[model samples]
Target: MSCTTAHAHELYQLYASHLIKRDIWDVKRSVMEQRFQFDPFAPQISCAGIHEHHKILDDLGDEMVVINQAYTRLWPAAQRDCTYLTSRRRVDDTDIYAVINYSVNHPDDHIPASFVRASAEVGMVCESVIRPQCTETSLDALTRQDIQTKIYYQAKISPGGWVPAAVVRETSKREYPKFLHQLGKGCTEHFSDRPLDCSTVKKAFESRPPPAE
Candidate 1:
């Protein structure tokens, strides 16, 4: 997990752009096409309280049609297409985001004979809270910088051909942490409103001790 001063909405926008915007895929050197079938926040819903916001999110669901092409060392280059159900919800002070493949098919979507059909599930939660700081003098007042958002992310993906589960597991173990570090650096840059030295951030995250098993 990582902490940032960015608000939940800012982080949500970042995540949404990465998934929905075509330019982001281009930056990653992947071919992607996305069409939105449904959008819960299309008109941008507004609510007065936290409970109302949560209820609106639960009631309205978003759906998208996607086609992606990529190459990986563990598998041959292939294209996959699928429809996904995407959602964002607020629970108390925490914001949750999720995307899962839907069984429904879009008439316009077709996979080539050489391509592999794949599916994935992703979820992330961000909690906003005041983090206490250690100081020489005993004080209770919290500074603006003390307010932080904590993020947790999880993803389950299948390449859908004959790829071994062991290979997938090992790949995730090596790649997921790197993804998190990049995300942390992104959040820090957004929060600070300035670009940070990549080497400094890399060293900081890499030097941290591993999580307890």
Candidate 2:
């Protein structure tokens, strides 16, 4: 398939947000901090260019905003844990981004830093999976092409490939933002702001008892 500049730009905007929330930056720091014996970097599934290319994607109208918000909501589906940080990297020319979930309870795990680094490399591919379907139900109507065009890249990042800009060609803030804006009773919008921020997004969620409750 062929990609266009518009779609590329939108993807870039969305990806910029993805890296932050996904802890890609933090993951990199963890590797560098540990030094050798604790070899830096995490293992990945593929060396797809998309992982690094996230910072750049088509600027397909306002589609980027929708995908960005979509990613944030679905992050927990695959992430599952709040304490661990994640990072992705390209494996040479292949289209893969090995995912690493760094152990956050370093003090409690009482494991050596080198061990932790080693463990992250092993956990890279297996633990990461499809975007949480339940969370991304709003995109239920998305076509296969749509999946590949918009969500596929970040959902399961890999390299040696590219998504054409035409995929999200029809998307726009006017059309897609409403989906994100409508979720959780607009809680993400906050009391004073026009859009969602870190503080208000999770405010509307109600804690629940377990199965026995």
Candidate 3:
């Protein structure tokens, strides 16, 4: 089969073993096309190492490992911190409720505000899968703004969730790195069959363990 983007093909080759084993190739394929296509000169931005296509694959493998580890599961369950923001989107009540429920059940074991923000964005895109009307393109300017606010708040409220305010502010701006913009596009294209990858790597944002005194 033809590849969606160079990055997607590279990712398939890189993690073909694990992806096929998990039966996650289908989801990864779309993620590749929409989010992983590499761009050398496309603005240099990195959100938990997902700024480029190759890194996205790295994150997926790492995240899967982290998810399976018992130690990693000790983190508290996710919270309803963004309710204030999600409440505004009356049209997206179903998704909002779903997100709230998921957050409560699955606490983020890993603690990197950037990655948390990234995850929230990914969750929103996933929600769009079920609620197509809420796709990024379909959203009006105001609703989109609300989502940004929600993303930032979600990250802010999480334990040890203190990412730079600039990063939060940047989410609302129009001039993001090319890869992010494309990811946003992918989030909206809901039915596109392009090879995509959405799994993220925890090591990318892994805080270093304290050095021996």
Q: How many residue pairs clash in each candidate?
A: 0, 35, 13
Report lDDT per candidate: 0.37, 0.26, 0.24
Clashing pairs in model 1, backbone N/Cα/C closer than 3 A? none
**What is candidate 1's lDDT per residue for 7-39, written digit by digit as tens?**
333434455433321211101012222421211
Specify the highest-TM-score model's number.
Answer: 1
Order of all candidates by TM-score, from best down to worst? Answer: 1, 3, 2
List TM-score per model, in order: 0.47, 0.19, 0.22
Question: In model 1, what lDDT does residue 22 have?
Answer: 22
Worst 10 residues of 3 by lDDT: 21-30
Q: What's the lDDT for candidate 2? A: 0.26
Provide the lDDT at 211 for model 1: 33
Ranked candidates, highest lDDT first:
1, 2, 3
Candidates 1 and 2 compared: the better one by lDDT is: 1
Off by over 4 Å in 1: 1-13, 16-75, 92-104, 134-144, 194-213
Cα distance off (Å), candidate 3, residue 167: 4.6
